[model samples]
Target: MWNPLDSITVRTFLILIGGTMLSGALVFTLAGTERKNLESHLRTHHAAERIEQAIQLLDSAPQASRQAIAQVYANYGLRVDLAPTVGVVGQAPDSEITQELRQQLGSDRPIEIVDQENKDCPAFTGPHPEDKPHCISVFTALKDGTRIKLDVARHDHPPPPFRGNFMRDLITFMAGLAVFAWIVALMTTRPLRQLARAANALGSNLKHPPLAETPGPREVREASIAFNRMQASIQSYIQERTFMLSAIAHDLQTPLTRLRLRLEKVSDPALRTALVADLTVTQSLVREGLDYAHTITTDEPFELVDIDSLTEALCNDAIDAGSEITFDGTSNTTIWGSPLALRRCISNLMDNAVKYGQFAHVSVQKSAGKALISVIDGGEGIPAHDLEKVFQPFHRLEDSRSRESGGTGLGLTIARIIAERHQGRIILKNMGVAELGLVAVLELPLAPSN
Candidate 1:
């Protein structure tokens, strides 16, 4: 059997997985980008402040203070370089102050110094070669013309390894989503699978007892209730109709019998004979109608039986009656159903073939989830349009209503009712032989328990 879970439609699975993946991607991407941006901002602002403080300390201190300031700069990840001033003797006095002062004031543009009064002034340059090339440089000038230059390099700390970490996190999230998807599939599919099995069983045989009411969400419960009610209604209706038909057939028989007795006393032989013939035909029809009605109410009591045994019995009976009959197919195959009803259905087809076609050939085959029982014959085939009509009660072929043919026109109808009771069907059609013949095909669902 094809399981409902195994055959879950593609649309359902796509909806589940697609929704989860899209939501996860959106949240992960936005949060990861924000975290990276904030870290970048903090590193840049802190680096700028540390570099400025180191430059101020270097300009104000003595040689000892310079060493202390350098230590502080190392701690804060800053680099500083200083150069003293030089000048010609007595022209500008050639003192440290004159040389340093000349260098500090050498630039044409006005230099902004943080502590010009207490420290030697240093002229600002672009930036130190070792620092970031585009950094802003700060210079301080001192009293003795010693210049202190501080290079505040732009902060360019490589971003934390976001790509690699994000990929790992994404993989983990996807893995969790996959597990969650399967879990949801199991929960949702399990109930539907059960319902499918129940439907298949019911289709195969309505007499197999209606499915029990399933407990679950509202939709499933409602469906179960409706199916059960429908099954009960159908069963009750068939039983009621069958009972009414039986009563009618029984009540009509007495009046028909009395009329036949009264016609026997008629003095005119031809009139008496014609009246009796009409009564006989009417009585046969009543009996056949009751038989068809009974078939509708009959429920097959299923039991495992060898299919070959049933076919052999039908064939043997036909042969003993001097009809050419044959059975073909596997002998070991077994199926579940009412043996008497199934045998009768097969026998009825064989009888029709032999009556109209002079011989009967029976065969059985199994495929997929069904069993086929076929009866073939060699005779004039029924017309295409009349094929379905023949299964209706009292219907007869236009040319075959002679007394010798001897049928109440209910044979096919009864057989059909029996097949339907077993959750099977009967079909009649031409076998396409040039010597034209009828082929009756009976299809029955394979019993699951068997």
Candidate 2:
């Protein structure tokens, strides 16, 4: 399941190296073809000149020395021999090789190649066939009026083959390219690291500065700009929601107070008791709404707090409220957080456990640079499917629907929101190992006490 190519660095390195090799090969191949073309053109014209000159020089020599003169030219890749014929039986006057050679030679004398062999053509298709050398028969009259055929054969010039230092140079270039690709991969990764750090800082503190719009490549710069815009949108949304909730709370509280006073004047004791109870429940729901909104909009700055003592005070307060709650573990730690929000989060957890299960057990500990607090209770555990749904605002479980149970159904929602606001997570699960119960675990990032 793990693949090296899945890594960004490996992928980038491989792509760069492959592209460099392919491009280099393409360039070298094209250049080699053109170079061979030009070399063959020059070789054809030069061979024509040398063949003609060698024939004339040899013919002008003394009759006894002509043979030695021919041997000297033959050793220099030009083989000269005498043929009996002064002309071919029938053929074109100017072949492709002759036309090109005549242009350089500037001789009006009829010129013909041996089977048209010394012509310029692509390397794949040669001017001469293998196993038989192209014998150039230059039929010309010497200055002494002697007619003879000079049969000349020159070996095809081949380019230097790949070997020795040629191979070493090619291999060195490839190795250097691979190193360059790795450096490019490293250069590309730093921008991503900066982006990640900025995002994490934004999550921990909403007031984090925006990322520079032009700090990296185009894609990274655009992503950072989008992140900054999204953060601003979220901040604005929270402010707008808090203002709306403030107006609603103020408008609704005055009517509820008047209704409570009016109900106190009812003649029948049973009727007044029931009405006042309903009014109190409505008030509790309104207060819970305000609490949830505050969780979203609170601008509380974090401070160093003794978490152990904070949770201790919450447990003591729950006991005073006639809840059967016990603190079962010690965190013995200090953390950076808003003291009021953390206390509210823990108090909600304890209230849920004690109200639903008749008793609450609380524990806290430090694990892997995180502070974890778990509130557990002994009761008929919620069904597996309903564990997460209970955290939704105004969503109550079927068993706790009676008015006498007295919940505004926003306790768990507010607690989870507060945890997230502090860069933490809250999860509810059935605690089934030893008893039929549930546990609400809140895990918060551990901050330095300083």
Candidate 3:
């Protein structure tokens, strides 16, 4: 049931196992220093005891029985010999092995310590199966005029060079860690990718379905549920507001008509003209208000729309209406959105430009897989402080471009809403050169290519 390829599980297990291994290794290393000291004491103590026993037996036994005694000790893996003391190396090496042997052997029974370079030194054999070239040997003269040699050897051959089982185990651990990391990455990233896709789709499609609760951690499930509820709340609020505005607009229509009929009967031409203008302005505001509400509530199906041709046609329409609206440039691409909504968003911007600048320049370009449509105008650019304020519904700057000049102020607001519904946004900036113009940029995300 174990999947080595599953990245999340593998990573989790490796981190768990690696931390355990590291802790174990650290403890072993720390204890190794103490262990070494105990091992040295035991070695020296054991060797000194064995040599003392050999010395006692040889010294107490008769000359004829010495060989028999040595042979008996040899059976226990210790070699003892009664050899002549000719060319005996005198001084011992200044090391713990020498010092321990001397202290245990005692000053009264001082023995000859074998020098390492002495060619005649005994070829010592140890209890281990492997052979060792280095060891310590002691020599003592017996009371009967014969000398005996005692040898103690330790296993000191370095473990065979590192290319055997060690390399294989190291490679195995690294492979396991890599697999664990891979598995962990896939586990976390897959769910996160799903969340990202859902988030991206939400901006363009309010009716997009809620994210399904997946078989994952509780945190991820909770986050998905929260996102769904938030989306539903926003959609509900928009629908309710739109219904209220539409009802109000429909109710006011009859009253507006009766007022128009009554005003038509007035005989004062100048006064009637002023009243009619005011009434017309009110009617325009109310109509635009209803339109704004509809824009938010309307959920049109997205369709393929050619951006270049759309901008060119809008330019022509403005030109026909006796406006200096020119197509500066265009890109070759198609977008996916409500064609009516996108056209209206761009048209509103163009109308705004001409109303203030007396001219409008439109262009379309693609960058980083997104389409950018810019509406530039030669109007006295908005004050830096009032730029954002102008986007509020029914908000207007009190300059020559005032509300009296026939603007609902919902133009920018509606344009912003449409842009956002297409998963894009709009930004306004003052044009270069004396800041005499304003540039309204609409950025729209392009449809994914199949």
Best lDDT among the predictions, by candidate number: 3
User: Over 4 Å off in model 1, which ranges?
Assistant: 1-10, 45-49, 52-176, 189-211, 258-281, 322-324, 355-358, 365-371, 379-417, 420-429, 445-450
Clashes per prediction?
A: 10, 0, 8
lDDT of 2 by residue, 277-349 (tens): 9999888888888888777667688888787788888998888988889996777777788999999899999
Q: Which has the better TM-score: candidate 1, or candidate 3?
A: 3
Give the alpha carbon lDDT tens digit for every residue of 1-450 in model 3: 966756554566667567756875788667765677676667667767888778877878888898898887766545676885454444564476666766766666657666443333334455444343444567776766576776555344333335468779867876886676656656766777777788888776667788898778988989888888988998798778788988898788889989988998889999899888888887888888887988877888889888989989989988998999889676687889999999889998998998887788899999888889999998888888888887888888888457568887888999998998888899998887563489999998887751
Which of 2 and 3 is ahead in lDDT?
3
- Per-candidate Cα lDDT values, in order, are 0.68, 0.75, 0.77
The deviation in Å at residue 410 for candidate 2 is: 2.7
Error of 3 at 286 (Å): 1.9
How far is 1's C-alpha from truth in model 3 (Å)?
A: 43
Q: How accurate is candidate 1 locally (lDDT)?
A: 0.68
